[model samples]
Target: MDCIANLASEKAVVIFSKSLCCMSHAITRLFQEQGVSPMVHELDQHPRGKEIEMALKRLGCTPAVPAVFIGGKFLGTANSVMTAHINGSLNKMLKDAGALWL
Candidate 1:
């Protein structure tokens, strides 16, 4: 959706999350620990949260929270993110997306 795209493109790293979701928190913490300040949207607190969640679902996000976008592109959910981190490709992706200087 245009709304999601606009928000995602506003920053090098964007995370659509729910404030109470543990996975969302984990993802946020991971980015912070990596020294990347990502733009995070707490969907549960957003006015159009329900609509946005639906949009994410339509886009193939099952849980619909902790959806990540990097360089204005949709990356996968928590599992994929964790995989990338484990494989050490997360830092490279962050650097490529301008979310990290190192």
Candidate 2:
């Protein structure tokens, strides 16, 4: 849990992801398209990946991968991100987190 927290706080926007997950890819692309350079941690390639995944599971991430954090706060899974985007709050969050200047 401490590891997860530390990693999440390392940047304005952090995405805990698996390199090949399509959802993770899409979410990353979305942020990039918006000109937000999020810090992406590929869990499958991390040494303590499983431990982090379990921690994310405890935090209620159903699929574990693609867990997101903004401004050191947990923002949840792919659905949550997509919903925030659809509701027009995603850009606000990005700006607030300093991941977007526009």
Compared with the true structure, all predictions reach lDDT values of 0.93, 0.94
Q: After superposing candidate 2 on the true structure, give the runs of residues whose Cα lies further than 4 Å from its correct spot.
A: none
Considering only N, C-alpha and C atoms within 3 Å, which residue pairs clash in candidate 2? none
Query: What CA RMSD would you report for each candidate?
Result: 0.7, 0.6
Please tell me which predicted candidate would have the highest lDDT against the true structure. Answer: 2
Evaluated against the true structure, the overall lDDT of model 1 is 0.93
Model 1 Cα lDDT, one tens digit per residue, 13-100: 9999999999999999999999989999999899999999999999999899899998999987898899999999988989999999
5-85: candidate 2 lDDT, tens digit per residue: 999999999999999999999999998898888999999999999999999999999999799999999999999999999
> Clash pairs of candidate 1?
none
**TM-score per candidate, chains pooled:** 0.97, 0.97
